[model samples]
Target: MPYKANVVVRYKKSVLEPQGQAILLSLREQGDESFLDVRVGKYIEILLEAENLQAAEEKVRKLAEDLLHNPVMENCSITVSQDD
Candidate 1:
């Protein structure tokens, strides 16, 4: 009965995140080789209830870009749905 918004935030695959690689190495050293293959990335999902799809989409994108993600190192995708 209302508009909903979803935001997904993740690191750019091309960025070299040494920290993530280090964590993977640590996992391997600890003998959890299974975790060694883990490719670390950030993913965030947000749901917004707004008066309209356009508003919800705009609000969520602003929130993600301004507050939730590092604009230089990360990127976000947003989707809004309304069937009211």
Candidate 2:
């Protein structure tokens, strides 16, 4: 079976995000004031072949916690879906 994993990485609310602020400023300057309060984060989608959804989800969660995110100042969420 094939599984798709989505990893969303974001800085903790208590952490200051300079990159997100910079991007937000740039967007505002470009006349997208609608994004004035928007916070930017990293998004990644991956495809994997696994024996089952549970296994795929476990692997994806570890990948997010161990390699995809900085546990020190970031929080990560992962979702896994099976492909029929």
Candidate 3:
């Protein structure tokens, strides 16, 4: 069966994100003073053939940790689901 992997990659809490900061500043300037902070991230979806959901999750997690994101500065979340 084929599975779909949804991956989200974001900067670690301790890491600085200039682009996110810039966007936050812009929002604040636009009268959105309630905004505190912003962290820009990437979303990626991959489809792969797997034997089961567990296997799909494992494969996606490895891909997210190895190829989809940099573990040093970024953190990743992977979700696997059956494809229609």
Candidate 4:
């Protein structure tokens, strides 16, 4: 079976997000003061073969932790689904 994984990587609260801050500043400069803050993150989609949903989730989670995100400075979330 084929599985799809969606991974989201974001900076930890204790880490400074310079890119996010730059975006927020740009938005404010464009006259968008309605936004208080902004945090930028990365979204990755992966397709892989797995025996079951549980196996897919576990593999994707491990991938996210090992290669997709920095454990010290970033946090990651993963979603796995069957791919047709």
Candidate 5:
């Protein structure tokens, strides 16, 4: 079966995000205080063949942890769906 994976990699709650803070400052300066806080991260989607939905999810998770994100400072999650 073929599956689609949606991955999100973001800094841990306890980690500091200088880029996000800079963006927040800019937004506030532009009079956009609508956001309480902002954090920047990566979003990736990939399609791959897998034995099953569980296997697809596992592969996606591994990619996220092994390549897409830094496990010590970041957290990652994957959502899987059938491509067919």
Candidate 6:
């Protein structure tokens, strides 16, 4: 069956996110001080054929590790589900 994988990639806590910081600064300038900080991340969706849920999850995780995120500075989370 076909499966859908959702991947979220974000910088590690130790890494600085310049883009997010810039956004936060802009918001503050606009009088939105409610947000103390902001962090930017990437979201990706992949569709593939898999034998089972386990297989789909494993495949998506591998893809996230190898291509979706940078291990040195980033972490990734993945979710796998059936494609309707």
> What's the true lDDT of residue 81 in model 5?
98
Tens-digit lDDT track of model 6 for 1-84: 999988989999989999999999999899999998799999998999999999999888888877788889998888899999
What TM-score do all the candidates reach, one by one?
0.62, 0.82, 0.86, 0.89, 0.85, 0.91
lDDT, ranked from best to worst: 4, 3, 6, 5, 2, 1
| Candidate number with the higher lDDT (1 or 5) | 5
Which lDDT tens digits does candidate 3 get at residues 1-84?
999989999999999999999999999889998888899999998999999999999988888877889999998888899999
**TM-score of decoy 1:** 0.62
Residue range 32-65, candidate 4, lDDT tens digits: 9988878999999999999999999999988887
Q: On a 0 to 100 scale, what is the lDDT of residue 3 in model 5?
A: 94
Candidate 5 global Cα RMSD: 1.5
Error of 2 at 35 (Å): 4.6
> What lDDT is reached at residue 65 by model 6?
76
- Which residue runs of candidate 1 sit more than 4 Å off their true CA positions? 1-4, 30-37, 82-84
- Candidate 1, residues 1-84, lDDT tens digits: the string is 366666666678878777788988888878887763445555665555787767777787778777888878877777778744
Question: In model 5, which runs have C-alpha deviations exceeding 4 angstroms?
Answer: none
The full ranking of all candidates by TM-score, starting with the best, is: 6, 4, 3, 5, 2, 1
Clashes of 4: 0
Question: Which digits, one per residue and each the tens of the lDDT, describe model 2 over residues 5-38?
Answer: 9898998999889888998888888988787565
Question: Candidate 3 overall Cα lDDT vs. reference?
Answer: 0.92
Off by over 4 Å in 4: none
TM-score of structure candidate 5: 0.85
Q: Which stretches of candidate 6 lie over 4 Å from their true place?
A: none
Per-candidate clash tally: 0, 0, 0, 0, 0, 0
Candidate 6 lands at a TM-score of 0.91
Candidate 3, residue 46: how far the Cα is off, in Å = 1.2
